[model samples]
Target: MARWRAAAFAAFLFLLLAVHCRGGKTGICYGRNADDLPSPDKVARLVQQQSIKYVRIYDTNIDVIRAFANTSVELMVGVPNADLLAFSQYQSNVDTWLKNSVLPYYPATAITHITVGAEITESPVNVSALVVPAMRNVLAALKKAGLHKKITISSTHSLGILSRSFPPSAGAFNSSYAHFLKPMLEFLVENQAPFMVDLYPYYAYQNSPSNVSLNYALFSPQSQGVIDPNTGLVYTNMFDAQVDSIFFALMALNFKTLKIMITETGWPNKGAAKETGATPDNAQTYNTNLIRHVVNDSGTPAKPGEEIDVYIFSLFNENRKPGIESERNWGLFSPDQSAIYSLDWTGRGNVDIMTGGNITGSNGTWCVASTNVSETALQNALNWACGPGDVDCSAIQPSQPCYQPDTLISHASYAFNMYYQKKGATDVACSFGGAGVRTTKDPSYDACFYLDSEKIINTNSTPPPAPSASSPSLPGLCFTLLLPVLPIVIASGFL
Candidate 1:
C-alpha cells in the first residue's frame, strides 16, 4: 500500500509539472534603439508583469542586464552591426568587452546567449564579410574566459539571404553570399549555436497582396494552402512554408544538423498608405495564430516534432525607430506601456481578472502595474511552465502584476487541445490553448465554437449580443491575443 501511495504521489507531481510547461509560450525581443522608453528596471518590470521569461536585446546594456538580476528570465544580448567591423579586427577589444560588460553580470542577470551581429547576412554593406571574424573572436574570448560552454554565440539573419523561397523544397541560399556563409555555418555547428533567422510572412503578403491568399498567410483553415511540387509537401500557412524554406536551405548546404531558431517574427499594427495590409486586427491575428501554432509545437513539414524556439519581434514599439512607419509598428506593446492587444493563454475566456484597473471587457488601456510579480503564484506558474532547470526554487522573487485576465467560461464548450513536443522528449503532449474565436453579442461563446489540433469546431450559430456595452468586440476568425491575460476586444477582417 505504501509503495502504491508513493507511485500515486509521483504521478500527481508529474502531472503538475506537465501542466506548468504547456500552452502558448512566447518571448519578446526588447530592442531599445529609441531613447524615450522607460529605464531598464522599469522595462524589466513590464516584461515580468506580462510573465515573459525570454528577452533578446540589441546590445549588452549594463543597466538592462543588471536590472534583470536574480530574475528567472533568460536573456540574449547582441553585438550591433556597426561594432562587427571592430570586433572582428580587435581581439583584445572582444576580451575587454566581455570582461567589462558580460562577465560581471553572468548567472545573476540570466544572460544565456550573445548575438554577434544583427541581420548581418542581409545587410547591404560589405559588413557581412566581417561577421565570421567577429563571431570567431567573440567565441575565442568566451573560451578564454572559460565561459564558452555556458553562453552561446550566434547572429540573426534576415530571410533576404534566400535566393528563392517559393516552392520551399527548392529553397536555396543566395550564391553571392556563399563565400561568407560556408565558414559561418561551420562555426555555428562547431559551437552548437542555432542558425537564427528573422522571418516576416507579413512582408510577403504586403508586398504582393494580390498574389498571396489572406487565409493562407493568416493560418485560416478555409484557405487551400500551397503545395511544393518538388517535395510534394502541402503548407497551410506562410509561416510554416517560410520555416520549411529555411530548413531546405540548410539541408542543401548539408548542415542538416544545425538547429533553426526564429530570432524575430511579428506583424505591424499600422503602416503607410502603400502598406495597406498593416492594421491592428491583422497584427493581432498573425501574432496570436503564430503563438498558438508555436506553443502547440507545430513544426514545419520537413521537421515535425521539432520544437521551434522563437522570439517575437519586440516587447514595446519604439517611437524613435528611423524607418518606414511600419518599422515602429511591430511591438506587442505601445510606447506608453499599454498592450497593443490581448492574448488568450487560457482557452476559456470571460473571467474578469482585469489587472491594473483595466475593467474586464473594456476598451480602456491597462498596463502591468509592477516590475516584479507576486513570487508565490508566478513561481508556482513558472515551475509549472519550465521544467526544473538549475533554477533555485527558493530564491525566486515576486514578478510585477501580470496582465489580469478574466475568464467568462461558465461551461466546457468543447475539449480544446494544444499539443507540443517536449524539448527532449520523444512523445508529443497536449500543450498550448487552441480555442477558436467568435464575435457576437452572445455571452455564451461556448455555444458558437469547438476546437481541435488542426481544425476549429464550428457550431455556426450567430452568437447572441455581448453582455454589456463594455464587452470587447467579438473575437476575430483566426486571430486573438493568446498570451498576456489582459482584457482585449476583438474585431474581424485581415488588417
Candidate 2:
C-alpha cells in the first residue's frame, strides 16, 4: 500500500510540474499620451481589478511606478529614444536614471524588464547607432546594482526590420540595418533577452486587403490556411505567420536561440472610412483570439509548443496620438475606465466582447473538489488553481478564516470555486482535470465563503456588457496554489 501510494504521488507531482513549466503570459500596454487618462493610482487599481498580471509602460513614470508598489503586477519600464543618446554617452547617466527611477521602487513594484528604447529602427531620425551602447550602459548599471539578473535589458523593434516575410522560412532582415542589427542580436543572445517586436496583423491587412483576407488576419475559423512553400508549413492565422517570419529572420542571421516577445499587438476599434477592416466586431475578434492564442501556449508553425509572452497595445485610447483614427483607437478601455469590450485575462472562456453583457446569470453555482476523486488528483488541481489559474488563495492560508478545516479538500474547494467564479462560473471552468464538480449547495463553512458568479462582476466605472456566445470555448488552463502544509497533510495520512 505504501509503495503504491508513493508511485501515485510521484505521478501526480510530475503532472503538476508539467503544468507549472508551461509558459506564455499575456500582458497589457499602459499608454498615457492622452490628457483624459485616469490618475496613476486609479489606473493601477483598474489593472489589479482586471487581474492583469503583466504590464508594459512606455517610460519610467515615477507616479506609475509607485502606483503598482506592493501589487502582484509585474512591470516592463522603458527608456525613451531621446534618452538613449544621453544614456549611451555615459554609464553614470544610466546609473543616475536607474537610481532615481528604478531603485526607489523595484521589488515592491515587481519591475521585470528595462526596455532601452521603443522601435528605434523605425524612428524618423537615425538614432539607431546608440541603441546597443545604451543597452550596454543599462546592463552595466544593473550589474552595479546587482539587479542584472533580476531585470532583463532589451529593446523593442518594428516588423519593418524584416525585408522578406513571405513563405516564413525565407524571411531575412534588411542588410541596411546590419551595422546595428548584428550587434543587437549578439547582445540579446549573450544576455539571454528576448527580441521584442511589435506585430500588427491589422496593418498587414490594411496595407494589402487584396492579398491578406480579413478572416485570416482575424484568426477566424473560416479562414483558409496559408502554406509556406519552402517548408510545407501551414499558417492558419497571420499572427503565427508574422511570428514565424521573425523566427526565420533570426535563424537566417544565425541567432536562432533567442526567444521572441510581442511587445505590442492589437486591432483598432474604430478608424477612418477607408480603413474598411477596422470595426468593433473585427477588433474584438482579433484581440480575443490573440489573447487565447498567446495564453494557450499555441506557438507559431516554426516553433511548435514554445511559449511566447505577449502584451496587447494601449490599455486606453490616446486622443492626442497623431495619425489616422485607427492609430488612436487601439485601447481595450476608454478614458473613463470603462471596458470597451470585456476580456477574460485568464484566457479560458469564449464569450464575445463586441455585443457584451454580464458573463452568466447563474449566481448560486459553486465549484468544489470531488469527494470521489483520488487525493492526488485533488492536490494536482489545487496547485494548478493557485498558480497559473490565478485564483486568490490567500484566504486559505494559516490564521486566515478558511484555515480551520486544514484538509486538502477544503483548500482545494476554496481555490476551485475562485477559479470557477473568475472564469464566468462556467461548467468548463469547474473541470479541474475531472477532480472538481459544480454544486448548487453552498460550500461555505463558517467564515469560509466560496465566491459566486455575481461577485465576479466587472469593477470598471461602467458595468461591462453581458457576454455573447459567439466565440468557441478554449481549453481551461489549470492554476497551482502553493500550499505550505501539503507535505504535512500527506505525512499525516489525510488522503
All-Cα superposition RMSD per candidate: 16.3, 13.9
How would you encode candidate 1's per-residue C-alpha lDDT over 72-137 as one tens digit per residue?
899999999989989999999999999999999888988888898888765667798898999999
Top TM-score model: 2
Off by over 4 Å in 1: 1-25, 345-495
How far off is residue 154 in model 1, in Å? Answer: 0.9
> Which stretches in model 2 have alpha-carbon errors above 4 Å?
1-21, 351-495
Candidate 2 C-alpha lDDT tens digits along 42-87: 9999999999999999999999999999989999999999998999
lDDT of each: 0.65, 0.81
